[model samples]
Target chain A: MTAKISIRGVTKDFSVRDHDEPFTALHDIHLDVRTGEFLTLVGPSGCGKSTLLDLLAGLTAPTHGEILLDGVPIEGPGLDRGIVFQQYALFPWRTALANVEFGLEAKDTKKRERRERARHFLDLVGLSGFAERYPHELSGGMRQRVAIARSLAFDPDVLLMDEPFAALDAQTRETLQEELLRIWEKTQKTVVFITHGIDEAVYLGQRVAVMTSRPGRIKHVLDVEFEAREGDLRADARFGDYRHVVWTLLRDEVAAARQEAPVG
Target chain B: MHLLKGLRRVAAITLLAVVWEVLPRTGVVDRTFLPPLSEVLTALANLAATGELLDHTQASLGRSLAGFGLAIALAIPLGLLIGWYRPLADFLNPLLELFRNTATLALLPVFVLLLGLGETSKIAIILYAAAWPILLNTIAGVRGVDPLLIKSARSLGLPAHRLFQKVILPASVPTIFTGIRLAGAYSMLVLVAAEMVGAKAGLGYLINYAQFNFRVHDMYAGIITISVLGLLFNVLLASLERRFSTWRATS
Candidate 1:
């Protein structure tokens, strides 16, 4: 299968104070995201999973190497990619429908057409009754649903989610994960989802890319071959084995990161 | 229940008015120094019938609204630009601070010199005084926007202008409206001071004119009208703030 996103040896560096050494956020990262696949980047905090997603989204320039969308070199943010954030960043003043219509408006779609498109997405996300309500009026789960609807309204080729369900409670998170899978199945768009949750990665992703901490680099990429449905997967024998293998790879990286920290 | 609450409010106001009327009539205070409530109301009615009170009230309202509107127009865009762009903010920061620190009322003489002793000078002073709260509040509002929201907008492929319209502007609105309401009150206060130093119109002019003519009843009426007008403007802006901020719980 052809890759929708190709990251070739991408490296990102951040400058500290003046004259101080630059901090490397990502080191020699090379990854391929297959078209119409759900790929999850999983690791501990500071593992540069978010940085990698940013690079893929064309929000930041890599200090080294390159990222290409389809065959074209990724330059800056464009209409082909949509992003959902952990904080559910819906426009506060806009009703749920209008917030979803924002991308269509940016593309200068006609008013009636934008409204129809936005309403369709809102209905898809189970928010049809709440189209007129503002973001602040919605509950946390409802807000995230609205965020998802807003992103999906663009009908982008790829959806980049940076821990989109991380801020939610466990029940809400699981429900959203299920909702996301249903949406992904229906939309058939490639998704690059970043998360710290190993279970979430196992449950939702076709492939899980595990990274080592500090100056983060990919340690392993495991293709999940478990039952596709949500129920009893955690109790399945194969699921435990995959979790243990990913956990073992992650344990050493977490230890190494802790050892390298400067003591006060 | 709502009717009961309304009746309670009326009863309290009537009680105060009765005390005010009875105290002066019973010689509890010098009648010349303190007019009875009846006399004050009679004077207010006479001024209203002659349309003199409405003229002064309308004049004050016009000046305050114009000054406040100009301040809002100038402050919001400048503040948003300053907040969004670091270099622009750095350049404007010290200048804005200096202007904010400078006594706005002290510039009354300068306005008088430049615009002359006319409505223009009075309105200019009101603008100068009202501009600071609005400008500073707008700056604060824009600066206070959550960075996460901006990141989300950018990552979602929103261009600069669209990001501002979709994310930054809506997020900063509540704080900006707060600034506007504060500026609304400041406009009236500054306009009154400016009017006192100048022409032949407005509540301040009427008060000064009444003092010279020794129409103590008209002076009292002017003072009461100023208070009522100030309260009405405050209520108007406060209601607007409430209406706009229904989506924003924190504000």
Candidate 2:
């Protein structure tokens, strides 16, 4: 299968004040994101999972190597790749409808058409009644829903999400995860999601790539089983088993990451 | 409870008016120097009947609005440009800092000398005094736009100009309004001073004219008129701010 995104020999570095050597974020990373698949990257805190997502979003460039989209090198941010940040980053000045219509406006869509598409995406995210509400007026989960709708309304080839539900409570997280799966099934859009939650990684990913600590590298890629259905996947024994499997691989990495320069 | 609070404010204002009328009439202070409120009201009516107050008020209002509008037109675009393009800001910061630090009213003599004792110099002084607040606040407003908003917009392939229009401009509105309000108040403050320097009409000239003629009541009328006009301008600006800033916490 042709990969929608190709990452090869990617290394990221950060320059610190008064330090001669730069901090390494990702060390010689290699991965292929196959088309139309949900790939979750799971790792310890400071394992650079968010950094990797930022790279895919083209917010920052890797110090070495390159990322490819459709055989074309990704130089910087483009419309073909959409991103949902962890912070919900919705413009406070814009209403939920205007926020959803953001990408459409960038594409220079007609006002009437933009409104229609925005409404459609809001309905997809189950937030149809909140078209006029501002970001501050909405609940945390609803705001994230608007953020997701915004990413999808643009109709990008790939969606890169950076721990989008990390701020939500347990009930909201589970609901959003299920909603995400349904959206994935309906849209069949290629997704690359980053998370530190073991069960979240296990349940959501078709394939979960576990990473080692600082100067992150993929240690293992586990194929997950089970159909994404309506009921809670946490109840399934296989889901529990996958969670255990990922936790075992990730525990040492977590400890090592927590000890690694304290992620200043 | 709200009604009680409103009543308190009304009672306070009424009490102040009573003191103003009674205090001077009682000779606590000279009646001519600090005329009774009734005499001042009578003088205000006389000035209005003779169209002196109207002409002076119209002149002052026109100068302030003209100068304030000029400042807004020049400052907003320049501030956004400086804020967005770092190299341009780098080039301009030293110069801007030097000028911004200098007292704006002190430049009045130079403006009057160069532009002459006309509306030009008065407007010029008001613009100078008014520009700094708008310029500085606009720079802050543009710079303070949430970085994530810009990043997200860029990732969606928004070009620079569209990014400014969509994200930067709307985000800057509240702060820009803050600057505009400051400029509005500053325009009145500086325009009055500028008018005092040399002007045939306006509240400042009227007050000076009254002082020379020993018409203390007329001077008070001019003072009261200017205060009312300043308050009116502020109310108008505050309403505009409220109207545009419905989506966010302005305070």
Candidate 3:
């Protein structure tokens, strides 16, 4: 399979102050995301996993190196790459249907068509009866589901998620993870997920890319060979081995990240 | 139940009016200094019958609404721009502060000199007084939008316009509405003061004319009318706020 997203020698830097020294957020990052694959970037806080996702989504340009989507240089944010955030960012004034329709507004779709399409996606996300309810009226998980439906409504090639379940309760997160998997399987869209949760990474990703702290760089890339369906996999002997290996690789990096004072 | 509650309020007001009507007639106070409540009501009826009350009310309402609308139109977009762009805010903040501090009523003479002592000058004074609250509240509202929400919108590949429309506008609605309500109150207050400066009509003019003519009953009538108008405007805005915030309340 061809790589859907290719990041080669990507480096990102931030200037702290007018007179202060510049800091590197990502250092010489190189990664490839295969088409229709679920890839997770996992690391300690400040390891620049979210930064890497931002770059991949073309929300920010890389200071050095290029990110190509299907071998085309990313000029700016486009509908081809959809993003879901940790906090549900649904528009408070808009109902679920309107929120989903927002992504399609740039298209030349008619108002009736947009509403119909939005309704379809809302139904897909189990919000069929709540198209008229505003974001403020929904629960946290419901809001996130609306966000996901909104992104998917655009039919984007890749979905970039930044700790999309971090703010949710354990039960809600697990339910969402299963829902995400079902959606991903049905859509067959490539996914680049960033998270700090090891189990989440292991459970969802075809490959888990672990990173080291400040001036973040990739430490290891492990291919997950677990069953796609969520049953007895946690109890699998190989699952424990994979977990142990990832934990050992991340141990020192977590400590270093904890010790380092964060700078904007 | 709501109708019953409203009836109770009307009953209480009527009781107070009855007490006022009885106190002066029963010699509890000097009748020369204080007219009975019935006399004030009689004066109100006379003014209404002659169409003077309606005319004055319409003039006052026109000035207040015009100034209030102009202030909202000017403040919302300017405030949003300043709030969204830090450099612009830094440059404009000091100037805005100076303008806000320059005692709007003090500008009455200058406004009259520039626009002439007509309706324009009066309305301009009201606008000047009303603009600051809306502008400041808008700035506060825009700045107060959660950064996380902004980040989320950016990540979702929202274009600049959509980002503002979707996230910034909705998040800032409560604050913007608060600014608008404050501006509404200011407009009413300043319009009265403006009319008092030199006007031939409006409730303010009527009050001033009554005081000069020593028609104390009409003066009190004008004062009561102004108070009622202010209360009515406040109630309308409060209902609007409730309508907008209903979704927030349910969740």
Candidate 4:
């Protein structure tokens, strides 16, 4: 199968005040996300995972190397890639439906069609009754659901999530993760989810990419498999084994990340 | 429960009115300078009968509205630009800071000398005083927009202009409204001060004229009318703010 996204020799550098040389956030990196694949990237704090997602979202550009989508070099932010951030980031002035209609408005869809599609996505996220509620009115989980519906509303082919559920409570996180998987199955879009949770990485990703910290680089990519994912998957022995593998890979990097002097 | 809350709010005002009526009538305070509330109400009724009250109110309202409207028209757009563009803000920052600190009232003589003691000077003073709060607040509002909201809009391929309209403009509204409400109160204050110093027909002039003529009742009446009008204007602005930003939690 052809890759939906290709990252080759991607590196990012930040210019710090009073520093003789620019700080490298990500060292030379290579990765491929297959079409319709759920790829989770797990790394220590400050390992440049968010920076990588920003690159994918085209919110920022790489200092060296290129990222391609279906063989075209990603230049800047576009409609084809939808992003979900850790904070809900819902426009407080807009109702849930209006927030979901934001991207559709950019697409210049007709009023009727925009309303219809916005409603459909809200229903998909189980927030059909909350179309008129503002972001401040919704609970945290509901707000994130609205955010998810918003990102998916315009029919983007790729979803780039940067710790979308990281701020949520554990129960909400699990519920959203399951909902996200359900949505992914229905939409068949390529997804790259960034997270610090090893269990989350194992449970959600078809393949989990573990990265080293302090000039982050991919250290390992492990394929995750289980007999069934419907229920009790987290309780499964195989789930624990996969979780252990990811933890073992991340252990040294996480410790090293803590001990290293923070890069300017 | 709602009716009880409403009655509670009214109780303080009623008590104040009762005290005002009783204080001078009971000889607790000098009656010449401080008339009973009933006497002031009678003076207000007499002014209304002569149509002088309406004329003075209209004059004050017209000048205040003109100056306030002009300030809003000029300030909001200019503020948005300065807030959005760093180069312009940088170039103008020193000038803005200089003028912002200069007291509007202190420049009253300059306005009177430059424009002469006509309606122009009073309106000009009102505009100058009102513009600062609105303009500064607007600039602050634009700058204070959540960065994440901007990122979210851009990620959806919103062009520059649309991003401004959709995200930046709406998000800055609450803060901008705060500035506008402040401007509303300032416009009334500066207009009254300017009219007191000069002008033939406004409520301020009426009150000042009454005091000189020793029509203490009329002066008190003018004061009460202007106070009530100012309160009503504030209520209208607050309602407008609520209308624009209904999404905000009422608290």
TM-score of B-chain for each predicted structure, in order: 0.89, 0.95, 0.89, 0.95
List the candidate numbers ranked by DockQ, top first: 4, 2, 1, 3
Residue-level lDDT tens digits of model 2 in A230-250: 476789889889999999999
Tens digits of per-residue lDDT for model 2, B127-202: 9899999999999999999898888888887889999999999999988999999999999988778988879999
**Which digits, one per residue and each the tens of the lDDT, describe model 4 over residues B1-251?**
99999999899999999999999999999999999999999999999999999999999999999999999999999999999998999999999999999989999999999999998998999999989999999999999999999999999878899999999999889889988999999999888788998789999999999999999999999999999999999999999988887776731
Question: Candidate 4 residues A155-227, lDDT tens each?
Answer: 9999999999989999999999999999999999899999999999999999999999979899999999888
The CA lDDT at B61 in model 2 is 89
- Cα deviation of B77, candidate 1, in Å: 3.7
The RMSD (Cα, Å) of candidate 4 is: 1.8
DockQ of each: 0.57, 0.61, 0.48, 0.67
Q: Write the per-residue lDDT of candidate 1 for residues B142-251, one digit (tens) a residue.
A: 88888877886787667788888878888888888999899999998888788888778889888889888888888888888888888898999999998887878741
RMSD of each predicted structure: 2.7, 1.7, 2.8, 1.8
Candidate 1 residue-wise lDDT, A112-163, digit = tens: 9999999999999999999999888888999999999988897899999999
Which pairs clash (backbone N, Cα, C closer than 3 Å) in model 4?
none
TM-score of each: 0.92, 0.96, 0.91, 0.96
Question: B63-154 in candidate 3: lDDT tens per residue?
Answer: 99999999889989888989999999999989998988898888889999999989999988888888888899999999998787777667
State the DockQ, from 0 to 1, for candidate 4. 0.67
Q: How many collisions per candidate?
A: 0, 0, 0, 0
Q: What is the TM-score of chain B in candidate 1?
A: 0.89
Q: After superposition, which runs of candidate 1 have C-alpha atoms over 4 Å from their true positions?
A: A227-230, A259-264, B1-29
